[model samples]
Target chain A: MQSNQELEGFRVELRDWLEANCPAEMRGGEASESSICWGGKNFEFASDAQRDWMERAASKGYTVPTWPVEYGGAGLNRAQEKIFKEEMDRIGARSPLDSFGIWMLGPALLHFGSHEQKLHYLPPIARGEIRWCQGYSEPGAGSDLASVQTKGEDKGDHWLVNGQKIWTSYADKADWIFALIRTDREAPKHKGISFLLINMEDAGVETRPIKLISGASVFCETFFTDVKVPKHQIVGTENRGWDVAKYLLTHEREMISGGGQGLSGGRALGAVLNESLGEGQEMETTLRADAMRCEVDALATGLTLERYKDQAEAGTGAGDASAMLKYMGTELNKQRHELLMAAGGSDALEWDGPLGNRPADWLRTKANSIEGGTSEVMLSIVSRRVLGLGA
Target chain B: MANLVMTEDETMLADAARGFLDKSAPVKAFRDLRDAGKTHDAKMWKEMADMGWAGVLVPESAGGSDMGHAAAGVLAHEMGKTLVVSPFLSTAVIAATALRNVSDARAEKALAAIATGDVTYALAVDETSKFNPEATSMVATREGNGFRLSGKKTFVVDGALADRLLVLAKTDDGLTLFDIPADRAGITRNAQNMIDARDSARIDFDNVEATGEDVLGQVDSAMSVLKPAIEAGQAALAAEMAGLSAGAFGMTVAYLKERKQFGTVIGNFQALQHRAAHLWCEIEVTASAIVNAGRLLDEDPDNAIMAVSLAKARATSTAQLAVQEGVQMHGGIGMTDAYDIGFYMKRARVGAEWLGDYGYHANQVAKHRGF
Candidate 1:
């Protein structure tokens, strides 16, 4: 563990910086996907306060605090990055920016992209100047993602890109798409793919929204019809995009797994129960027990996540142990939302219910087990890879 | 303050304990003792005390190492891994916690003797079945300057074998805890053959006389001392159960790798593999809860109720999963009496019911969570 004595001075400075710079409107901000600041050409902030907060955070390199200072970051270590987040959370200040560029593409670029590519791509992501979307999942390749049919023929100068990508989150608002293209059709499914960075402004690119059961259009069906992409824009070695994709998938999985970092903000199950059931009113014993069980399991999951991080900090990486975190964390998240709806009762069914986003949030959690990597796939990975139970 | 991951010192201590337990006492040793109709071995107890295990929570002034609760938890966790049946929890953890709270000369003497491997203590708390110390009806009526104790304490683990007993009794003021000899007049210990093959008994205290020196802390303040004692025992018990889960999981995984059916290992089958993986995740998560509980107990004892309850409840459920899956995955061999896995199943059952069952701790969690 990092010594507190070393972090004491850093923490005080961070706390003061957050308190002074973060606007009152941004503190305890709206916890909704619609209010998120996903910076793009057409991106408009929900309020002036939101815009100012993002600019201030970007200037201080708090958006991607661990990135190198040359790439618009604070150059903080993992320990300092943790302190930065904690100080921000202490003031109830919401994250200044959220996008696929900062989370998924930036890590892939940092690892697999060339030094020039990192210089060109990473700064914009860290500054939230451009929003990005992942173009990996297809109707044909959900769990078997390696069998991607998006062909990218070897056109000497600039390759031709064509195919469809499903579940491209915020595709309409995104300025670019990080996609996988088939460069060698004759090669094996996993061997032929190549990671491509394509601008959404390219003529053939189109995005159509797909409404979810929660009555939200957070995802889109993105089509790449003979779109032109410079050969130099490819990440990593060509026809080896599977390596980059897998590396990026781990980040995507951890982020969505919600191990102590779920989208559910603030209020706990018991507090929700008391709010709806009334403070003095006696609740159903079984429901109450269910709420308590959820709380206990959530506590266990959070500690497990922290332990793994500590293990990583101690130079013993989480390794195969991380495979199971996605399974446990996502399952627990789904369980929490299911109990949340149960606590909300008949009132939860109302469109504009007193339980703000409780109904929509409940439906959204259903996707948690399906998106990123399904819970079943995570279990299989744990069993076959970690446990060595494969035939 | 809550460091779920062990420090360098704690890791070394665990490594040492693992080496000692594997050599001196393993699963085979527990099986042998069960076959011999014995709950514990006195020579083994002496060796443990000689190694300063009995003094893990005891003070240096009383000739103990006084390694604190985290070190004691480390020892208990290693003991549980090998199914080492002893009075480590009852004597070193529970009784020592109660005795150390009182500054009397006799209490100090008892602790010093405990450090020397000359004394073992058991807690007598339960009345009928459930662990509700607040409802303890064991009367401690004033008789002149002394008190007459009359009550029956059931599920008294190590009661029949311990050198002394810590009894929770109701007094005119409210509830009082007494530290007295088990062989005292009017105290009868009827040994009950438990499923775990451990030394548990129903002790009857019929007008047992006790002086002022026998009382721990003061009259009507049993909760003051007993609360911390029980919480300590509960956290240590949680660690033991977590260790037990890992032990059972290790055995099951080994069996999975070796046992074959249909021209391949059964572990290769997706059905069993997923179940094993799920169990592993449960064990890992529950281990964090156990570690956090010990941390909170050592660093922040006053507000450790929620953490302790969460740890106990999570450990109890996780142990159930581990043993149940351990047997199911082991198939027919797991059910046979000749196998060691059955012993783990029985021991897990005992741990579940010892301090508090799933429902009991769940309620505690709900209460603190304000539901």
Candidate 2:
């Protein structure tokens, strides 16, 4: 571990730099989809301040601070990255960019992609020049992700793809997609799958937004009809994409759990409820008690996450333990929003106005348990893998 | 306030405690002691004191290892897993904490005696069913150079066997704490037959006399010493409950793997597996809260209210879940006296109401969180 003095010095320097570079407009704002910069080739910035903030942060590789400099990152260690995040949070600095490429695909590529492939893709992701969407869940496969039937037939120089992928979050807006394709039909289900990168702009590709209970089209049903993909675009072994896909799923689970923290941001639910009630007003005891329990559980979840990080630093990785985090965090997040809705009361029933996207947010949290992996499947995985329970 | 993970020395101490407890005082020992109708075993407590656990919070000058609260929690947690019947929490944690706050010669001697296992103490509070020490109705009227204590303290844990007692009594100023012998004149000790089969008493202090030397800290500010002691005990009890949960959950999981239903192992059923997994997740989260509580009490005891209450609340709820699931999954065997799962259920029930129940702790946390 580095000395506290050294970390303190670095934090001071980082704080000064953030103060000088971060736009005032970029700080102290709720992280909503409209204000976020996805930064694809066709993405228009919400404002000049948003564009400037992302470019300045990306130039320093703060978007993916822990990745190596050669891979378009600041080359920070874990402690430094934590310090960077803490400093960013102190000033209420909004994340310059949000995309699947940075969270999910970048980690998978860093571990399994070829050097040439990393150089070609990682820089664009770090700089937010490209947006990526995951295509692991097909129309036929959700929990049984390895059983995806998206066909990728080899044709000497290229591969022909034909299948449909559902729940491709932000797929209509993504520039590229990382998909699991079935290349070997006669082999075992898991053995036949391959992870391939596809350009969304390519011919015979289509995307249609799926309306959700949240009244927003955050996900799309992406279709690949006779699409051609270069043979070299495959990640890891051709028929062993399941390994890379599984590894990526771990990152996705961590990210989903982290999404709870993003929303929580250490804001007290009691205070939120008090504000909703418009001052000098007392929240009902039952609702207040429920909110406190949720807050306490959220705090516990946060501590659990920190403990796991410390354990991983001590050379004991939380392998299957991440499942517990996802299940609890998502559940707690939903509970928090549910309390928020109840706190809002009749005013909460309104679609818009003073309540501010909370009704939509509460409904959106429903997807947290269903997406990535359902809570039921997560429990099954924990039982089988972590506990080693046998038939 | 402190590191979420234990230090190297703390982890080593925990390993040693686990090894010794598993070997010497496994669940069988608890069962045997119960069969003999003994709520506590002085011989086993002497062995623990010989191993330096009785002085975990005491200073080296007072014949202790001074291993801190986290280390004490580690030992207590291990004892909890085996349902070790002892006075470590009441004597080592609470009594030591109370003694450490005041540096009087008697308190110092008491601390040294506690470290040596020559004496044990229990706090005499809770006049009613609940544990609101501030609501103490026990009055001590000034009589010459001493005071006469008159009150009944119900649910005085470890009071049955403790050599000394820390009694809370209302004085003209406010609430005052008196440290005196349990065998003092006019003090009647009638031990209760708790469902958990633990050493608890409902004592009637009929004008029990206490001198100025017996007063710990200032007269009216007894909370200065008593509050920390109680909080220390609460955190350790929380740690114990966390371990008890893990122990019960472990037994349940093992049973699930072995028990067969409909020609298949019961563990293979999704119904049972999900419940087991959900319980495991609850235990894991509660473990972190317990760890944080220990850390906070060690580093920032003044500001540890939120963390300590959360730990106790989470541990109480999770332990309840573990024992309930344990019994439900174990079928008829769980209900039989021959099985050890019932012991955990009883202990968890006792722990939930010990320092403070779930609602009490949650109220504390809610206040800290500005609810």
Candidate 3:
């Protein structure tokens, strides 16, 4: 545990270090899909400078700063890690890698994986040597996630997986998937599930990219036909996969909620609103009020997040309150993008090249309310669990 | 950006006020206050004064804690929860604000008295059912040693009980605020029973005399002080409305869980659950808006007008929806006097219309936009 003074000092040091090391070219402006470095089996870079930048950050473990040193991480404590994030933000440093391996799978593996699992999976995840995508949602089991029909039958020495996963983000580019499969069809929907880590190159595994309104193949329909997942890859208890699924869902919600700050590149929401809507137009009143309302809600949600982060740093988890935050934050995020589209008006309709994706990006935000747990589900959880409204 | 969120100290103050209100001024206290036709409770006022709530916003140099408007908003919020019948808002916030903004020696001294709970004052600003303080029709004419004020002020909060009335009057220079003693000759206070049962008054200032030294601000510069003071008042009212909405929403939720319909808790139904969730979100957003307005009021008075107006509009709509939906969700018991929801709904209506209605504030915001 570090004092506020110590944290401030660490922040200043990290600030200085980032200022000297980070290249001016790899800074603040938005990175296209081509510019983004996803270091997996298929990783490539257009320029030697970009490749060198990725290698430098990866070698120093700055790519995953807070992960354990043994797995190519700086191993900084929570406070120091926060300071590192703030410093990186201050210097406008671009992340060396952006993938499910870094954001979703890494944390889940750290928490639930065996020692062998951690050693094999984490180093690659930290080194940006693997790209992962989620395999959770199905056409029939969107919000009612417990009703997943994906099955994993145990063979003599391996597990045979057979089912379809829809809305699997980045499945087309992913090298691995952490999925949920029913190991016992006779058991209850929740009890029959099991967590399995699967290789994307396994025989009979297929991925078809879904063309989203955002003009990008960010999600895909993944089908597993007799795909063999090594028995050793089963995480936690085979029959008790629901617990692992619940844990992952919490992290997923947090990740989606955290996505709020990442969408708008370093610009204050107020500034964006002002630019989109000309100053003091009569027609802009409703839009201005809505934008202001969203801004205030964002601030409130952000402050609530900071409070939770503080508590987490102090080793006191907010538990169900995190659900409250996730619910509010995702709604606020959707509202923000809606306001942006409203502000952009006709200009928002124009989609070509990169700008073509703006409309899709806006449409993708609509999924936020539906995914992770529909807004309705979150509210029900809050009412029953947090508010104690139902016994 | 002095953390718009509540600090530990602010939370402690809020919790203490909440605890006191729960124990002392329950729904019964509100009933008693309303039934007795009393504008405020002296015992509760003394308890609050003892707790230093009255001095929460007043400068310490003027016998106050000088904590600022954020703390005052918190106190008002707790007051709303208990439906505490008091002139805390009218005297401590509105009048004290006018005095503080005026920044005169006499006004400062008056504020000191207010901070100490030794005196109470009401601002007589509203006339002709408008939110504009500059539209005041009360006249202040030059007289021998001082001035004579003549005209009427409607819906003066706590007018019958206030020791001093900070009357907004039109002088030859322009609109001015005059602190006329309620007991002064030619002053008549007729107590009016509002729909919410809160005590207000129609005050007639028939050539009431007051010295130029009693003027609140530079003779004609009352608009500067009045506008911001009105904004602050609206913000405080919005805070109270937020608290009231929270209370009503909480009560409705509790009743819904306990009162079964169709052999299951009403709360178990998806329709009721979604409705309650939406109301909760609305209240949460309203709370943020009001708190933001309070912060703006303290830091940037120039933007306070817009912030407060926006907050008032949001809160008025939020409170109205929460109360109406709360009652509907609670079933038939909600409309009965025995249930607490009706009282909250009435109080919310009063708050919504107090400084300005939602439409009025929205129009004001548009006008401020130069539309």
Candidate 4:
């Protein structure tokens, strides 16, 4: 509700606050695959300080700026939120919260959560008190996402959840999970699904870490043995969970696509390539052209993201168009990483410290085209929805 | 700044062009034109002109859409989709842009007529295979009241069919541009058949007469005018290349999905899927670059020159890769003359080599960066 002048004034004040509070040691530091953190998860050194900062910012609704002020968000317009991000990025200020709750569940809840549900959940998420993980992709269902067989049986007062989810990122570390379960056995595949929110600490919940090619155990296989979730935790109408899942997938794709842009604090692709390739490697004329081409694409994709963000703020964001952006962005990011790995050559294959880590990181990026939705699935969406090709 | 982003109006125009080309300019038409050794489809050209495509980039004051380069590029992209062979690029975009940029009233009127489908023009710039406009090899000297143009211009695009020719020549002062009528005395045209079956001509000008009025812009500053035109031309060609690459990639994917090999559709193979996915990514990236260049051209003409160079260089490489991979992925069927994939690949090669090859544009970009 603030005027443009008021927003500008707030930006200046926020910039000064960030400059004073952000730790100098945290600035310009390399991000590890394990921890892109200035402080640990326990908030050891500045635990109270970080918590206070988070609480103050959340109280002002700055943590989720575009969310309503009544719902514990800053209620800032898109331009103001952009300025907030710019200032925070400029000062190297780390986010108080970095979890699926902040990125995925919060947006879905805002759209589909009941008033009581929003009141109960939005505050805790905004305050960085809860970490959420996704439970959508099952062992049997990967790219054919709607085929999830996780069952949520009605048990009168509460629903009993029983099934397993694979590729559940941070499931062990998460405080809660938003899952898609089959609620109607006789109905069609997509129509039978339901979206439910469950506590990770519930009696029958379990998680086992899944080690990846990157050697990082970032994801897990989550199991629910008669896990009980309260009836109120179901998002939207029962058996319409597929709709909520689809909506959440859109947000997840947006997050993944946007993730490519802010990696390692807005470093230019050309700078990254030059740094990795070294001074006199004799970049073939063809390779130089390819690099410039990639750079142009990154810039264009970034601009497209900005344009779409503006649309989202205006409440007119195209749902399927986000898929197009995500599809293009993740693939481009993978290509960029591929180029970096190739430029690094044998050095990229080293796996000891940070130098040893590049190869693993590069290997992990191969999931970019597979995760969220397979690149093939994204194209099908584009051809059918955006271009109206297959009808 | 002109809105280089495609608006609804522009998208509608592009869709209309696509529909027309799909229904009218199919693969058979392209083959017929090639077999007949024709440069363009006469009926299809008239239809496109009737749709006001020839004037898509001209100013509204000159009885054209004044839509600008971005819209023109979109139209050309659709044309590239069906491989609609014509002088649309040479007459509508290149020649018209040259005349418009010159800011001469007479030239504007001539361009207006071209937009109305009553006139057509071609650019005679390339003297050799290299992309150096400065080394024109054509000379113009002062004579009584006008000027005499003397030179041999090869690969003059649509030179045989053009009503007017915009000739780049060197004068005593410096390089200049002259608007010479095709019927001028001592102007001889030798029509040449191109590899892709496009129309081109080797023009010989033996003391052709010209006046100051026919000189576009400043007499000695043709390079300035020529530079932007070349960039615009390159950008348009890149857009076309994007379309051609997309179509070819789509056909390959379709073929892969249908063709059974080893008791399964070839598309299901992990290796082929990966390759196809990579090519799709390349096409998307190239498209993003070309679209961005077009948008930048509308916003900043100067920066657009660099963007165009970058785009064309990238597109040339990417298109070649896409077509080669597309054909290889299709196996022997892709190599057959009956298959349309070869046509797309041939068109891509012609488009890539038209303005400058990948190496030339890369060097241009490097030079711009002070390398």
**Taking the tens digit of each residue's C-alpha lDDT, what string does model 3 give over B1-371?**
22345667778989888999999988788898777767677777777777787777688888887777777888888888767888888888888787788776787788778877888878787777656675777888988767889998888877888888888888887888777788999999999878778878898888788897877777877777777667778888888888888888888888888998789988888788777877776676567667767778778878677668767887888889988998899888887888788999999988987888887776655454443
Best by lDDT: 2
Taking the candidates one at a time, how many backbone clashes does each contain?
0, 0, 3, 5
- Please give, for residues B235-343, the per-residue lDDT of candidate 2 as tens digits: 9999999989989998999999889889988998888889999999999999899999999888889988888898999999999999999999999999998999999
* Higher-lDDT candidate of 3 and 4: 3
RMSD of each: 2.6, 2.3, 5.1, 5.4
RMSD of 4: 5.4
| Structure candidate 1, residue pairs in collision | none
lDDT of 1: 0.85
Question: Residue A52 of candidate 4: its Cα lDDT?
Answer: 57
lDDT of candidate 1 over A126-179, digit per residue (tens): 788888999999989998889889888777889898889999888988899999
Which one is best on DockQ? 1
The lDDT ranking, best first, is: 2, 1, 3, 4
Q: What tier of docking accuracy does candidate 1 attain?
A: medium
What's the residue-level lDDT of B249 in candidate 4?
81
Poorest 10 consecutive residues by lDDT, candidate 4 chain B: B1-10
**DockQ numbers for every candidate?**
0.67, 0.64, 0.19, 0.12
Error of 3 at B231 (Å): 6.6
Please write out the lDDT profile of model 4 over residues A256-285, one tens digit for every residue.
776654332355555555666656866656
Residue A185 in model 1: shift from native, Å? Answer: 3.2
